[model samples]
Target: MALSHASLSLISMIFLAGSIVMLFFVILSGVTSTSPLSQTYFLRADTHGISGARAISQWTYFRICGDGNTDCSASYADPPVGYAWDGNPNNAPAELAGGHGGDTTSSSYFFMWRFGWVFYLIGLFFEVLTFGSGFLALCSRLGSAVSGLLSLISLVFLTVGVSLMTATFVKMRNAFVADGRDASVGTYAFGFSWGAWTALLISTILFCIGRHSNKADVPSSGRRWGRRSRSTRSHRSYEGRRVKEEYP
Candidate 1:
């Protein structure tokens, strides 16, 4: 069975709301000391030798936190590509030491996270625009088309952002493990990032479907109106002829 325009709009709004919530949580991770949220992070690793570094560190979007999210560092717009440790480069892992052909703190790593952060903000902005326009989708075909276009744009930005984030952390985790350090990825951050993307994708698709359905209904409605007009005109002509004959 085909869903009406209103029904599709409602479902799309629900998915868009879910996407917004997931993105908010991901962005706010490590910004506070609250349970569950505070625990959220991208990568966790044992960094034992570097000075000014915790024995175990969890990297979040805005800052690095010590084990169990205690003693978090000051937040930044674009977090340092390195672990923000201060000490002899030799004590740090080869992947992060940066003095002798290391990757961490390099221009490549720095730009990756920086651009990824920017993309996330951009994606969220467009998603909000899509949601606001979605209300019109319930009644107007143009509204559905506009909302779908905005959602597609949001999805593109989010895809790039999440891909960069995943690549950055996955490589960092692998580097730590290669150095015989325990490393793990954060489940909440990973799940939320992808989950939000999935929801936005679905919302975009539903908006398109609703738009097309509205278009399909127009011609049939016009045909029905045409047929009713023709029958009414013919009935009026017959009544006129009968009156003329009786009067003559």
Candidate 2:
């Protein structure tokens, strides 16, 4: 049972590691949620030079990226403008087009890949929860199968976390690469730093621990036998009682 649990945790952590790596590159596709690209980033509309923090998801003509020029509309938009702001008229607010695609200047709209940070944080939280619950339980008498189930769940979520963070990192890196140092602060919010790697390592460790514990929990697997033994004892007692009653 313990070995099975350990196996679950180990596999989960391993999966998390792979996911985080994949996410790093995947996030680089979209734009970061930092200050507008100053007429940079995303597939801008062709009408004006205004920067649209719209869907950076598309890599096509107007959907690819243009700096508000005749060739590509000089904005990160298409025939229709998709702002990371309140570009929608019906829902447009007095402070629409304030950037980051929300009604208020400070507000944020999470279109396609607008706010990668939010998802990254959410992923982090779920990872932490899964890690916390099963970390210690790995070596305990917990059923290995249960641990394996949890590890599998954790691995799935770990992929989400890595993908989200990677997406955010990619956007940030692209913004920097496109605009240069003058446009953005040297470091991206979703950075490729020691801390990020450390997080991955920790998640991986927890996963292994969970899997390793699974292999040792053999007793848990024998519950059926234990139940049968108890039932037999009960039957014996009932028979003895019947015999006593007959003698009396």
Candidate 3:
């Protein structure tokens, strides 16, 4: 019932690959789009029918008659266009308006968002280490003890990083609520990015199981073969002793 090192290595590699893919989704959903950390609302406009505000952490944008009469749905983009961010609340605000440190109202949310990325980057480093360890395990190039140790360390880093990202999700949700936006409705709710987190968590668990597999003799065949060899040696020794006794 022992798991083979080869199998463990294979599984580890799969999990590591999945982790990397999930990290990409996390980045795309978080950095590229405005889900899990952004919200939009309607504001009264003097010149237009309504001004729109989309706030993600400290980055806020106002749009003059962008989507007031329409469905109020807008696309997310880098240096998001078609939005005013003058902070007027009644009119569109200036474009690209906000400090990197986040505004005073939602500074903590921004901090958490940035902090989560830091954790992810650190975790990526550990994941790379795990990749090397898994490769060594597969090739029998390293001792079992060393490979297992490295895997354990990598798992710890990955877990911490993913956990921090979970915290970011929570903070973002809270920020949505603080702005009087209903997080339960529409895109304000958790989306594909959240699903990525779930996938990441499952991958972590799989990696742990795979790492444990490496600690054993593997496939049970090796153990059986060893026992068979020992038994054969014992039988030969017995026969030799009997022949000597009879001859004497």
Candidate 4:
């Protein structure tokens, strides 16, 4: 079935909008990773015991990754409470302290900001893919190219992208479970993973839609109506043409 040019454009715009929003949230998660409270909230929400080197009155706090003596990394801890971070495997990383179960590692915060970039980059790529495929199919008139590439991009990215995000969500959940913060929080966090799932589904739809040409007319009730149109017009003109006379 054919999609109107307007419909194709609308679908692309919707996909772009959704991708941008997802990218934005992913970036926000990264920026806020700088704060201990935000870090703790997510960690706890995922099920990890949140603690820090010393209790600070604030909701968030930052500390160096290893001994202040010498380490290239920094860490954020939350609940603004008692715990310590030493790179030492023996001092018991916050992830292991009290045999705590929640987040996989106090270590993850060290890399959490990267997730934002990952999301933004992937989202941007998918948006570009949608727009490019659409342009090839609609504007460039390379409809076949859209069909061929759209399937590949959609299948690979939609599946792999969702998988990566799901893995991260699961790791977070395990962390929370280990720490014993509150299972209810992880329930809400489920939306994070579900959102990715939704994005994948929408992408699949758009990708499939792009693979076909807009010029292909859909079978509609109007087909019979259109069939009658030519006949009726010709019948009315039939006698008129037959009556034509030559001028002297």
Candidate 5:
């Protein structure tokens, strides 16, 4: 039982390590400024030129970035103008003959389209708690029950966060159509965010197993047997005394 418990603890830690790695990867993707899910564009108006890109997720929104040297340049949107562009109305630039079909000023939208950021951060907090508890259990500094409880809580938060993010993406896709653009699966891909969710889910399950195994390791059966044996002996002794007194 002890060995089994130890093995479970070890596996739990491994799952946690993997989750941490995925989370770090998501961070790296963001820091590199190369969105795991977004699009870039090149605009030209007469002699003027501009470069632009946008990336978005349920939990967060990277603002549309544009760089151009001329004010009268034309903004040639990507083929079909998939998700991520603003849907608000705007005047066409001199470069494009028709009206412009670009994203609204990113500043007009909140940092995160909805409360995706809030849920994501909250989920992160629970993940940290799970990590801490798992480490403590692995080191024998904390009991398995505590670690398991924390992991369960973390799982709930992660689930909610992941769901919210997915909804955000769907919302953005719908907005694309609303804004007179074509939205396709190709345009709205589930990138590193999905990977992160997968990792967290596995970690949560492992922690649950570790918690159950820990409870099994305690010597409860032996204690229960001992108590029963003692009670039987006491009852026998009492009967023997009563018989001796009656016979004598």
Candidate 6:
């Protein structure tokens, strides 16, 4: 079925809204341990007997929580991997326990998490901009082009963020398992993170398609007008010839 400009705009808006909502949930994961919402976390593991570490630790974007997010520490941006162990090198996993004196986490782990967190925020910012520009898509191809550009930017940021987040946590989980501790990934967090990226991708493609479709319509309409004008001119010439014949 062919989609009109209005239909494409509306669908794109819907997908963009969904992506925004999913990203919000991912960001807010460990704010509280309230029912299903608390299930949203990147990684969870048993860290029993570790100094300054919770018996059950759940890591989110802002804060690290305990016992399925029931108890959370103060929230902050770009939370360090060492936050899980109170920055105690002795309490953290071997891979994360930095060699330098007084260092709680390895340089790789620290920077990976920090960059991932920053990227998430950047992606969200661009997504908001795209949403704002998307409103004009119904009326103008320029608007669709702008929205598509913004969405593409958002997608790049999100793709990097999600990849880093996944790698950091997957390695963390493996480290915990190797240390004879139980660890697992949070299903809700995994789903939402990737889901948001998928939605934004679809929205971006739709915007681009809408812009091209509108552009195609213009030339077709012009061609139709050209044909109509030629036909009208021919009819007039034929009528003049008939009049001249009758008079002569």
**TM-score: which candidate is best?**
6
Runs off by more than 4 Å, candidate 4? 30-42, 45-84, 89-124, 132-155, 168-172, 179-193, 214-248
Q: Would you give me the overall lDDT of model 5?
A: 0.47
lDDT score of residue 156 within candidate 4: 60
Q: lDDT for each of the candidates?
A: 0.85, 0.40, 0.45, 0.41, 0.47, 0.86
lDDT of 1: 0.85
Best by lDDT: 6
In candidate 1, stretches whose alpha carbon ends up further than 4 angstroms from where it belongs are 99-104, 215-248
| lDDT for 171 (candidate 1) | 84
Task: Put down candidate 2 lDDT per residue, 7-81, tens digits, no spaces.
Answer: 555555554445455334323433432332223232222222223333222222122332321122233332122
RMSD of each: 4.1, 12.6, 8.2, 9.7, 8.7, 3.3
TM-score, structure 6 vs. true: 0.88
Count residue pairs with overlapping backbones in model 1.
0
lDDT of 5 at 226: 90
lDDT of 3 by residue, 50-112 (tens): 134533222212212222222233333222222333232342222222343222123443455
Candidate 4 residue 88 C-alpha distance from true site, Å: 3.1
Each model's number of backbone clashes?
0, 52, 6, 20, 4, 0
TM-score for all models, in order of appearance = 0.85, 0.34, 0.50, 0.48, 0.55, 0.88
Error of 1 at 192 (Å): 0.6
Model 6 off-target regions past 4 Å? 99-102, 215-248
Candidate 1: worst-modelled 10 consecutive residues by lDDT = 95-104
1-248 per-residue lDDT for model 1 (tens digits): 67887789889999999999999988888877786687688988997776768888888888888887778888888776575576334456666655311334656666778788889889999999999999999888889999999999999999999999998889888988888889999999989999999999999999999888734567989999999999999999999999999999
**Residue 90 Cα positional deviation in candidate 5, in Å, after optimal superposition:** 4.4
